[model samples]
Target: MMPLRNPKHAPAAAAHLSRSAGVRHQGTKRSLSAQRSPAAQRAAPLNLEIEQLREKGNAAFKAGSYSIALQHYQEAQGKALTCRPVDDDLQARILSNCAAAQLHLGQPQAALQSCKRALQAVPNHTRALGRAVTCHLRMGGFSAAQGFIDALRAQPLTQAEANTCQQSKDALQALVQQALARAAKAATAEEGVQALAALEACLEDSHAPCMPSLLLTKADLLLLLDRHQDATRMVLAASEAAGWPQERLERYSKWVHAHMLYSQGQLDKAATAVSEMAEAAADDECRPAPALLPSRSAFAMLQQAEPQAFRDLAQSLTMLHQAKEEGNNAWRRQDKAAALNFYTHALEGITAPPPVFAAVVFASRAAVHRADGRLLDALADSLRSLALCPLYMRGVLRLGQLLTDMGRHELAAQELGALQKEQAAAARAHAVNATCIDLWRDVDAALKKAKEGQRQRRAIDHFEVLGVPRTLCTDDEVKKAYRQLVLKFHPDKALGRCRFSSAIHTTCRPSLAQSQLEERVRAQAHRVFSMISDASTALATRSSRITLEAQLNVAQYRTASQQQPYSPGRYSGAYQPRSSTARASRQNAYSKTYSNDYYDSDYYAYERFWAS
Candidate 1:
């Protein structure tokens, strides 16, 4: 008789049972059937062992002992895959679990590959997709990460799963917005202070990540603000707190120290520091040493031979490329959210730049706004670029596009005609071609339609934005509504990580989502309560009189020059000359005597002496 396979390892049998269903083992008769096949008999014991190991791994993972869980998971994977041919579903599950473990272990690249494999095995596996999204996000593959987020959301999610997804989405959104704001600030010549102020606010927010990288960013901004001491302090503090690998910390600190030295005109010491930093950076694995070539070259040319200048420049370039690639990818994916994030990142990456660089950054931002269907924003950015660099063709083209979209066809046509004339004057045949004319006409017509649509939409007012009733709203009620609206539509809350439940909890907890959402809501409510308490005194003062008083004694002083002398005379011989001082003293005595007599009279009787 043929040997029977172990039913325990059969996915087909497992599929028939619900995940929570109990498994019952048949007795010795079935045990004997397993023993008939040498492979089955041998695999049965290993499969049982693997199952036990998997359970232990899961238990450890739940307890947050990820390292121990990883060991068990790795062992289980080895035993199960070698012991028998696992089904596709089981294989995918194993890969997904392995990827999760790797992610917790901080091996994102390995985790990404594992997740990809898992998804290949089971394309619709939510766990695999989630893991992939997280890994891609960590890797800075933002477009891919966003795509995965969308895909995950499209699937049916349990309440718990949905909450987790929402949290991740919120975190990504916050990061992207922060990156963009930084980019926009960096692109502007005069907005550094405003940007730093905003950045400081972000730093002050306890919930924000205060990582060393972010601190380094602040230090860079501080340097721009000519707050050298503050910048140095920040850099040193960041170096100490980075907790990165030794090489990374050393590389970062060396460059920062070198820059400080160079700024102080310690050229020889700065050069030495720069050399050391270059050597250390060469060996650093976290970031590529070769990628520092352009910066290193530039630093070599500095009058002071300061390596940090080169390093900063190189970092900026790398960040710029990263942002551009990310934005382009997001655009390709048609992910407006991700595209906007990356576009902002790209804009922020420009630190020191020529005027044309600003034009490029603005142009890219306009494109992002255009993609987002925010025509006004797009027009604003494009116009800003044109104002900065009037000769920038891209900005002009984008502005024309925005104008055409806004139904300002006459303006668009004029812009297009100017562009054509400029190009034709330069003998550029391609620039003033039929395609340009066609695009101009099409855009002009579209703009007219868009203007009509906008007119229709513009009929709504501010009250409509908050969906609030306009009838008889009291001052108190209006103030309350405004606060709610601010919390709801404040760009930061809308575009970044405003805890949703917190808004609900503070505004109206009963309407919030159940489970984990309640916790955030309650926290938000507590925050709101504190704010309300703090404002109560001011609010009360609005309708009431409040006074504060302090009593202070006034001291009177007489200078020697102003002092009077009694019985003083310059000459005396029976013909006595009465000094002015003596006359004044006599008058004072007479006045005092008369004043007492007057006070004794009933005219001022029993009145209290009041001091003002």
Candidate 2:
């Protein structure tokens, strides 16, 4: 017979069972001891209870009740350890569960540490490895996260588990590659800022490859942010990093060197570096996409000589437009919203455009507004286009002219004035011939006539007080003539000087009694001056020569009435040799000249000439 087995190792075989069967053998030592401790007896039952709790915890965790499940698992872990020594595998499993709970609770740092502990206990624990990778990555630890991913991939897991791990690892690999690429190519200030953000994220995952790309990116960003020295140091470090191709390293080195030169205002060196980089990039099979060229060109342009720099910028803008068009063909498909966005971007790169294009843009926006029933907004944009380029005369005249036809005189006047000023400025700047000015003057005269006709229909000839017709009077003449009449009609005149007492009493009655006659006279004078001002302003702004002539006739008549000689042609000399002082004094008075037109025999006879 084999040596007697230890009682602890025996399977259901007890010495008492054999003795009770009456088959006791002499000289055979009993292996089974009858002195089993109470602690020993409780151990198996305690283990069974702990296992039950563990199962319940797992169920709860799967059901998404992480808090409840954590409590149950913790209790189970305590009981399991108390009953019998817990093995490494069991400890790792417990810790993994806890880490999962922590992760679910958004405590990434806590989850990271807990998962790390679990990995320490059982390095091959697949769940712990996966969770650790996730935690690290979440905390921006790409390298360390990648390490965990590699370990997970190497494990002999079930098909589903293997697939999950592989997928996750692949995604992380892509992210790492992108991050590394960004870091390596960061050659400008903006790139450096981006690299910094990427690096900060990468720090969480320590196991990630410290790619040369990251360093390059940092250097580039620093250079862009004007940290040339820092960028230079980082670039050198990156250049020394292993695994990068010689061509790539050399290219990045050139770019960094050029950036350093450029930062020091070394345009020539920068240009040389840029040329070399461009050649290398162009010849290389791994050139960056053309979409990136515009921005690079823009940067390069900044290092160019002044005038050339502007030209380069303009070229870059063109390139940008080309790239944008290539990237977004849908913009050409009559998609209004998309087209609007595209045009808006393009517009930012330029100051002004030819009138035709400006009109189109304005018209497009106006159409949208009109369709939305925002007539005022639509009108405003259309008018703005006119203001920008009044050469779009048809559009300007139609919109405002129609508004005026619809009795919106105020809006029409505003639009007309804006168009006229814009056109005038453009003509002046572009060295338009004198004939154009004459033409503009003619148009201005026409618009004035229209405005005067409108004013006349309003039942007031404010400009008539100065003994002139509504036409041909300069601003000076209107003001001067008004002052002279005010003196003649003033109620505060000496009793002997009050020639038209009955007229004053009738005109300046209850509303403006004799005591307030001065105020009324001033008010009437202002009204007359305002009319003349409007006429002058309109004459200076009309776009139609035919209309302007009509306006001049009205002005000429008004001018004739306001002067001493009362001759239509007298005021012609007033503006012939214009002087600043004369202009100022004329503007200060009610009328600076008078015409005989309003003093026709019939009007004077009606006033009943009385000697003072």
Q: Rate the local accuracy (lDDT) of all candidates.
A: 0.48, 0.47
Query: Which pairs of residues collide in model 1?
Result: 183-347, 183-348, 407-447, 501-521
lDDT of 1 by residue, 282-303 (tens): 3434342332222212112222
Error of 1 at 258 (Å): 4.9
- Report RMSD (Å) for each prediction in the order shown: 29.8, 28.1
Q: Model 2: per-residue lDDT, tens digit, 1-612? A: 011111211111223222322333341333312222344433344357767888888898778887887788788767656645345556676777777766565445566676788777667665566566555544445556546655644233466645654565566557656765665555444554676688657533432223434444445455555565776666555444322355755655565565455333334444556555544543353232232222222123223223443344234434433433532454446465665555444334333222234444554555444544444335444554444334655456545543443234555566667767876787869956676666556456545644654564422223332344444555566556556645643334422121111110111111112223333334433433444445344433212212333344444455455454655675575534455675557434413233333344433332222110
TM-score of each: 0.29, 0.26
Runs in model 1 with CA error above 4 Å? Answer: 1-53, 71-91, 101-110, 120-124, 137-142, 149-273, 277-612
Worst 10 residues of 2 by lDDT: 503-512
- Range of the 10 consecutive residues with the lowest summed lDDT in candidate 1: 547-556
TM-score, prediction 2: 0.26
In TM-score terms, which candidate is top?
Answer: 1
Q: What C-alpha lDDT, on a 0 to 100 scale, does residue 389 get in candidate 1?
A: 54
